[model samples]
Target: MSAPESAPPTRPPAPELRGAPSPRLHNEDLAPRRDAAPWRTWDLFCWWMSAWHSLGSYTFAIGLLVLGLTGWQVVVALVLGIAVLLWGCNLTGVAGQRAGVPFPVFARLSFGVFGANVPALLRAVVGVAWYGIQTYLASLAVMTMTLKVWPASQSLTAPQFLGMSALGWICFLVLWTLQLAVLHRGMEAVRKLSDVAGPVLWIAIAALAVWVLARAGWSVDWNYREGPALDTAGTVSAIVSGAFLTVAFLAGPMLNFADFSRNSPDARSIRRGNGLGLLVNGTAFVLVSVVIALASAEVHGQAVTDPVELVQDIDSVTLLLLATVSIAGSAVGINIILNFVSPAYDFANVAPSRISFRTGGVITAVVALVVMPWRLYSSPVMVNYFIGGVGALIGPVFGIVVADYYLLRRGRIDVDDLYSDSPTGRYWYRRGTNPNAIAALLVAGTITLLVAFLPALSALAAYSWLVGTVIGGGAYLLAERVHPSGSLLPEPAAVPAQLPTQR
Candidate 1:
């Protein structure tokens, strides 16, 4: 199961030796690192803390609780789901740290120097959708707090446009502008903001939990029995589905994990950070969410899934304002790290010579607005379709990348060839596209799409991501066997002597 090796007609003069400017494929922004990575284990830990503290995470946890499972059963599902995410992150992160390149650049290794656009663009589209959704959620928090502090402004909700009230538009634009400002300052600003916001979020959630405990008492019921109780088989099915949903929620971030992992100082740091962030911080957040949901049901006479709505129910204006700010802060952090960074690099990768990182980010922001994510968020069906459908497509891309890197290529990649468009280049297969990878992607993605969209396969839709990954990986391996490509194993002599130095 290894790549084949064949000599080409000629080897172009090394760019360094020819004294030509660095190829269009090699841009300073997307190039491998020549300096040390600034992020450490703690920074990585904060990364997940910021990501999981969002309203989206809160809603996901609440979804598990209402699935008729007891609290302990929900806990078990959360642990299992986070474990899966942690493992995936570690696997993807290793290549990024070794190569010191963003996810799109790394993807060029398997998908071809030019063909990598398929997966990178797919990731960017997903990122745009999430950016819009998170912006809308954060705006809701601001709108809620504004109405609380000044009830007179509630009347401004008239003349709704695009399914959003006038106030909603104002708040959304404000939050959007703020996010753009942070992104304008580059990655340093993002890291500093996450470091502050993550701890503040923890304190805010802890305070909310304490308030709930005082109001609802310790005897809150963990068993959610709003409807008919499920039998043993049904309960087990629900637990498994719950875990799958958890993975779906995280599929976007997990696929592009290399976007962040590329900033890690070392592989050890990536592992330590992911363990603390995904496993420890993730489990704790889910537990706290469950407790809050249970207590809200007892105290408010109904379960409140949305954190913004829950904050609106609080009696004290001070606590309400604090909670709103914390939720907004968390949303902004996640939006920037998971939603903004990936697409910026992805879009830039599409036209490196013309599209700088900032321009790519602007493109992403504009597309997010065009998507009008508010309508999508307003409907449960739309949420399931958009989020779940995008997640399903991501699974095949993940499988192909992992299988190619770990199994076929054995973790060896030619950094120069990744950017090269020359026909003789290792990654320059058939006019800069690898038909095998594309075929495998299409086959796996088509099946996953069918399962997601076809009513006949409704029962199996929940496992669409898992199904796609397995089938996609297997299909690529089989495709490689039938149409063998040249060996990815590097020859020291053929390797570019002027490859970027790793930290």
Candidate 2:
């Protein structure tokens, strides 16, 4: 291709928010795409599919059986969960798709230019932790497969250092380095890899389910728990709790969907992608996972949550190699989307002028290294309290942003002012922070934290994500309505027929 146009037209493009003047907030990566944003409905559908068909998601369905609900009941919850995710993604995504900015940049509308970093940092912390955990899990898959083939190689695991064996470090670093190499090539490479790996991972999952079912003589025990069944009220409660658990699993991605959706050509295309991807593909994955978990338990005496372990137990070198490769690829695929990319944009938003997207991603990787995710993942107290504590803190921010943009601002964004720290700029409310936004965030976050931790509220723990969103959103509406913030601009006479040009 020829070298790009010198710069965008002096008049900003329609169907986008572009051309911020401030150096403190403007950069090539964070700026609206001057070139075509080429992703379409198919691309987004593949993106969601790629994000879902991974080692983590495969295990997710099996773990829900601990809820003591039947397979079909679990399926219903999964559907509701994905539906909730779809609703959120569409609401948040249309803003980004139309505005042509990542979540952090667009969020300035609600959170203020500098205060936007509050949400960014919150999301980045979560993304970095999970990024490390997923990489470690993938490395374990590769190492386990190797040890299975060559029993003598078990010697490499003798010395434990920094909570991982020597062989474990080697595998982890190798996977880590390879993933960075792919990311270094940029998002296009990430997209291509997902397009290929996502379907391959699901296909392998289907094969695994078929093989396990055949081995079990085509019969499945719905009572996967090996205990007395839950009563009617308990069963009803479990289904509701299980549904929210599914939502929480995808909440990190759903919260900042604009990271991906900003590349879409139009908002309608995003809606199409979300509909097909989350509704159809998500349902299929949950149903298949349920079938596989049930059959595997009957055949192997326990439900196999980890696909890698199940393939290894089949005792075929060929199946082991295929499953291992697929798991590694799909795990990396989802990691980049779910855990890596959002944080990259988020960290860059902290100082767009100083940090490029690649630099931000490296920063995330460094933090992930220090997070020592294996330790984080292993400690029950840590997982239950620390992660949940931090998670509760962030959930309210999503609601705050959505409420500010769609309801308060009436879906209009002043593109140039998003970059302006100048007190006179339209978005420079109260020296670059919206106090009302902060109040709602704190009030709702505290309640969500209580629901997650207090034993008296244990029954409500599973619903924390939903609770945070609703309470946070409702609080914002009430706060802004009762005490009007004059910082908000009046809505336009009508929605613009074309994108408004930026100076």
Candidate 1 residue 353 Cα shift, in angstroms, is 1.1
Q: How would you encode candidate 1's per-residue C-alpha lDDT over 1-503 as one tens digit per residue? A: 11211321122222232222235666666776534335667777888899999888888777776677876678778888898888788878877777677899888877888889899989888898889999998998999999998898888788698888989999999989899888877777777787778778899988888887678876567775445678999889888888887887788789888877777666777787888888889999988988888888888776678877777878788878888888888899899989998899899898888887778888888889987989877788876776656667898998998888877876776666776777887888877788888999999999998987899998888788887888888898889889976745564523321211212
**Worst lDDT 10-window in candidate 1:** 1-10
lDDT of 2 at 355: 91
- Candidate 1 structure, TM-score to reference: 0.91
TM-score of each: 0.91, 0.92
Superposed on all Cα atoms, model 1 deviates from the true structure by an RMSD in Å of: 7.3
Candidate 2 C-alpha lDDT tens digits along 356-444: 88888888888888889889888888877876687776668878888877777777676767777788876677878777777888899
- lDDT accuracy of residue 417 in candidate 2: 74
Clashes of each: 2, 0
